[model samples]
Target chain A: MHSDLVASVRRFNRTVTQRVGALDDEYMARGRPLAQARLLWEIGPDGAEVAAVRARLGLDSGYLSRLLRNLENDGLVTVGPDDQLGGDGRVRVAALTESGRAEWTELDKRSDELAWSILEPLTAQRRQRLTSAMAEVERLLVASMVVIEPCSPNDPRARACLRAYARDVARRFDDGFDPALSTPVRDEQLIPPAGVFLLATLNSEPVGCGAVKLHPGTPAEIKRVWVADTVRGLGVGRRMLGELEEYAAERGWTAIRLDTNRNLTEAIAMYRSAGYREIERYNTEHYAHHWFEKRLRPPRTSGSRGHSDN
Target chain B: MHSDLVASVRRFNRTVTQRVGALDDEYMARGRPLAQARLLWEIGPDGAEVAAVRARLGLDSGYLSRLLRNLENDGLVTVGPDDQLGGDGRVRVAALTESGRAEWTELDKRSDELAWSILEPLTAQRRQRLTSAMAEVERLLVASMVVIEPCSPNDPRARACLRAYARDVARRFDDGFDPALSTPVRDEQLIPPAGVFLLATLNSEPVGCGAVKLHPGTPAEIKRVWVADTVRGLGVGRRMLGELEEYAAERGWTAIRLDTNRNLTEAIAMYRSAGYREIERYNTEHYAHHWFEKRLRPPRTSGSRGHSDN
Candidate 1:
């Protein structure tokens, strides 16, 4: 027989999907399909990129293009030059016409009604469960669906997650981070052979990244490890780390080391959990306001590779 | 400079870890080192195999042997007999001695104290945040870490998560679930090539899994998606589906669909948000549950992908 989980999960998916509205075809469909309506609302006062539109809606780009096309065909929106937003030739912009804006507002109200309709049936507690569960499901799904591809050191998503992480660090640290003062280990040093970069993807979107440097002698220095705001609780950071550690361990590195400003509580816990013991200060990486080290146990027979520690 | 989020996470972790006594050398020491304590605990009133202990801890066989030796050396536990649980030679077992029972009780008390200390801090709101965040972190971590390595089907973690998912549905359902009557697709069909199963993990622990089975000639079916109670809000089910859908897409399948009983409200909402739509009844496999479908978009380009309708 098949396992019991499939049935149970199917059951939960069914129950939740129903309560979450598995049946409503007419949600944003008062007069327009849901995606088109969403796109109309998303188009800015000036204009929006096909990419920006896609990002906001979290839709497949092709699917997004189709929705934009439908709205364009409806004479409610225009998709033409990206020049107004100063984009080069490759980027096309989509903007709502006056009529499109009016339609969008009306559709927006309808969307609200749709949300309310689904919300009306459940109790406050159920609503909380539904919302929280939906959110959690969304977050986790996004987290797992994200593949940690090895990207260039300067990849935009990787940089973006790092900047967010840095901005967050600057905000939290007693001495605000000066990218110059805080960014540690030379950038060139982080490039391959010495170290590698990893981009964390959720739903295939890059939301986080980490980096590690393998010096000729010292412990592998973990750096640039950060998770995106959208994926804070999805454990991307930890996975990135374990990957880095395993990668280091595979290389026969006897120890792994990382430092954080004292503010980072979770990183410390994570390191501790992975058999890392807190040793005294070890590195001079400028951004490393706090130093912690752990003796890496030998790798399992399962040889593995890939990483980012930041 | 360190990120505030990192700082908070670190602080939170420190607060919790200390409260939980997670890093104390004697934390699990229980009158013995952790290795010995673990052996004593594992060797219950009924004996267990040396192999099982190694497998459960992912310990090196030598490491386990050493641990067993320590326990034996202490005269608190013994591994004298290889009582086979099953037919395999790998099934050797270990049993606790009289002193081992007393030691286990002390360890149990310490563990309880640790749990309570970790729980006792802060107001209800913080506890809620901690548990919720822990749940969130746990789910995300579990979902990310879940190894989708092939198993012959009845893998216990998969089964446990599924059963938990089902029990939840049965409780939530207007009419309780009838596992025997409700399954639309049976177990053997969930095997690979035709179907894929995903298990969600946190801290290397499995918390959720979902499977999508190609229904022989019909459109593929989405079956059994369950998240552990510990990770329920971490958005695991959604991730499972996203990964499943992507996998299905790769298999050259189009128009993936699923069925659920009317009671599964959350699942329905997830489907709707992810862009699945309702159609007239499509299949009645054995369960013949309520059904839904979504048109598959084109094959993904190499660029990052976005989220789902469900």
Candidate 2:
């Protein structure tokens, strides 16, 4: 919260808001305002559940319905019960009409052109720098929004996060991973006293998960550390590691360990940098190439001091 | 632009606009609209001529008057002819009252707080990354807005840019730079047939300048290659170099050379990367530590093919 930091951020806000014409009544040369344009975009190519759109945008249900009604009146979109359209029939969904699709395409094209305009004045080299910096900023911003919360292992979103993580590792591992083959933690085991599951969510949608198993006489074992690729490099992996360590320490465990395949270089690096020392294989995990262990102090009661660099 | 590049920029635009609340009906809890707030900011501490304010914001005179009138009615500002207030009555000027200054300070503080809110959610590491990325984005965006145009070296803005450049180099260089001591290019020398001056402007404000001296038999010598710190990393230096080379080539000068002080590490690096080859010292100037020359190909005539990146 330094003044210099605040100044830089404010300057960034001023420049970008002006550059993107966000303050203009019209957006991207489109006749409609930005909110409508954004809604049309959220409807997207495949459409979306109306409730999901409302949730994603954090809009009130009444406000969202009014906006949808405006789009409908303009003949650009339609809202109907999902079940009536071969969906669940209960949840409402929004979809663009033919004209809406065309309008959205035009908007999309112009949005690209606007982006091009921002890039066009620079040489090829600077363009690359700007784009890469943008990618970095986007990643960090998304990471900032991800909230890590303890969730029941059996909770639907938490389960979904775990299933996605397993699917990703299965695709990436040399010998495809199978939950059946790996050491299994039942829902009961992931509950308090045995273990706890942590879910990382971005705007309320779970994007990553990690879990830790407590042992009475042995070191706690951290497991299932995974982050969505979209949020990688935002330090989510390290944050989750720190959180799980605190979770273990809260249960009076002083040592922790985790195993990973050699192919997962980034995760290995994260673990190494987070104060975990490489240890000789202590388990019979078939695909494990590296094992790491870290000694933890009793949990710090002062919340402000626990966030050591990872 | 590549679709990926465009998509990245658009995504950046979306996230920043949302985070900055640029689309909100109110800004920073300010009661007035953004335009009025912006005008208040532009009026600044010392106040500004009404015409200058209008020109700076690119606002129509009528619209500017309306906004000023609104501020006046709110008892936040006062407008009066220059002669009536102080000296010349021809131009009208606007200045904030005591209440206006207090309100402006409050708005400024709230602006900083809003910026802080964006950073507060992030951990220390991510905050650093976000701030650094924001600085890069700001640099590039400013660079993208700069338009380089051939201007008379004697033009007021052109000379202003050159003066600013000289002042900067004077502060940066060891012995300090003096236009009187450096190889002098008379105003006549910088005019066409002998040389050409290129002015780099962002929103009509001169931010940088460069000049090339063409000789009948020897390679053209580029001088005063400078970009304001505000627009430095956007590659304005490189673009200016390329443009100067093209300007020289158009007049049939096939090679170009420039000299720089050792303290100017970034300029030297840019020269090296832009295909300038180091040579034995070619200038008698006291501060020149490195001299670079580059053989230029005939300028590409096709406009469509030249902008390969964006």
Candidate 3:
């Protein structure tokens, strides 16, 4: 960790926050603190589930509730049971009143204006350069934001990634993907002793996943590596692969291998770059066009988390 | 401008604001609001002029005074006259008290921690990539933030830029620069109708300057085109050049030219790229090694601010 890198990041954080009007007492001159204004904007005209809004904003329950209460007192919003959904009565939802909807529209317009203000000062060429660099920074920051940790395959988030993965492959594969034709992966097999499933999430919303199965007498078998389109090309998939490899390597497996379809060119490239090499057929999975394997080093210490020094 | 470019910028603003903890009520869990904490941190142990602090933070006078009062009430700071410095009694300065200095140190530690937190999740390679991208974004954003507008040559900000420009040339020129040996520019000549002086500022601090003397019967002459080291190579010089040329052209001058020391290699390169071609000696400035000229396009409309369509 170079101190200069940290210093550069700190400088960026300061400059960006000031540039974005994050310090404004009344954002866009809307007569509300930035946090409250952002909350109102997030709630939107269509309303939102209380828990979902809280999670999206990463706000504590008490803080979120207070913000909601302020809007409620101002007659701009209402927080009540989500009875209209015909589901959980105890679950709350926040909806905008007529005035609130108008305010949200104004905020939307102001948001556009704010974006324009940053661009307005630069010439066309500089504008393009600024936005291009901004996109790169945003992509990399998002990649850093993604948290990959062991998750039960049965978890809804993990299931969602798997479903997405299947849909993606089906759309791209020549013969179309069919889980029925593939080797069955039992949920229990992905649990602790047998294997581990690593789910990659940004703000707790699953965006990618990978799994490794540690069979007693074989090299660990990697499977289901996938990254959501929103995070593609930002190295999320590569991070998932590394984490899956580490999971097996730390648990005493010496190597890991995965099969992939020819249509998955990017994944194959990533594997090759990550030190995986072509190998003889490791499995007869219906969709696999190539098999690749990599030998993993033993964990530096038992139960040690690899790459913690970073 | 592309709509996708604007969308990308908007996305960057949102993600960066959230990632930097800008929306937090108590930044770094300091109990004070973010604005207050930032103000305290900016004041520092050495103290600062109230006006300077307000300008740096882009805060309105009333709002700044309110923040100052709050800090005073909390016994974290003191706002008083500058009599100790033998300055104006009405001019106030804000200085941190013992507890405020301690709090500022805490905030500094927390800021480093926040930067580290962003890096901690990433692999060493990804960390490097992220920091590199962040530096790019920061540089470009600073470039975009620079606002160039016609200012009185006598203005303090403009004078500051001229002083910096002199110091910079003094160090770089082969024979060393002396203002007395150079062709003199008068304040009235760089004022409206005679000519124009453009000062480039970032958050009210001048970082660059350029001037064009629209002489009645000859080509417009450019002078003192310089950018501070802090913002060099970010296109501030180019923008200033463009703006100066536009100023001359809009006022009916068909061409602009300037003499530069050979040692100013980057400026010479920029001149060439900006359509300036080397010409025979234009004047007998003691240190000038090259002279360059460019034809300016007529303004699209009478009194039109060129490039506003962007």
CA lDDT, candidate 2, residue A234: 76
State which docking tier applies to candidate 3: medium
Which ranges in model 3 have alpha carbons more than 4 Å from their true place?
A21-40, A43-51, A58-109, A169-183, A214-221, A248-296, A301-310, B21-27, B44-51, B59-106, B168-183, B214-220, B249-298, B302-310
Candidate 1 lDDT score at position B103: 78
For residue B114, what is the lDDT in candidate 2?
78
lDDT of candidate 2 over A93-177, digit per residue (tens): 8999999999989877777777888888876777788998988777777777678999998899987888888888898899899
Clashing pairs in 2: A83-A89, B83-B87, B83-B88, B83-B89
Q: What do the candidate models score in CA lDDT, each in turn?
A: 0.63, 0.83, 0.85
Candidate 2 backbone overlaps, count = 4
Where does model 1 exceed 4 Å of error?
A1-7, A15-24, A31-47, A54-70, A83-86, A123-125, A179-184, A203-205, A286-289, A299-310, B1-310
The CA-based lDDT of model 3 is what? 0.85
Q: Rank the candidates by TM-score, best first.
A: 3, 2, 1
RMSD score of candidate 3 (Å): 5.1
Model 3 chain A: lowest-lDDT 10 consecutive positions: A301-310
What DockQ does every candidate get?
0.01, 0.44, 0.51
Tens-place lDDT digits, model 1, residues B66-124:
87887778776776555545566545567777877777777665655443443332234
Residue-by-residue lDDT tens digits, candidate 3, B1-310: 5567778888987788767745332455577776788889889889999988887878999999999999999999999898575698888989999998898898887878778878877768778878887887888888888999999999998989899889989999887888899888888989989999999998888999999898899999999898988898788998899889988988889999999989989999999999999999979988888999999988887565533755
TM-score of chain A of each: 0.77, 0.83, 0.89
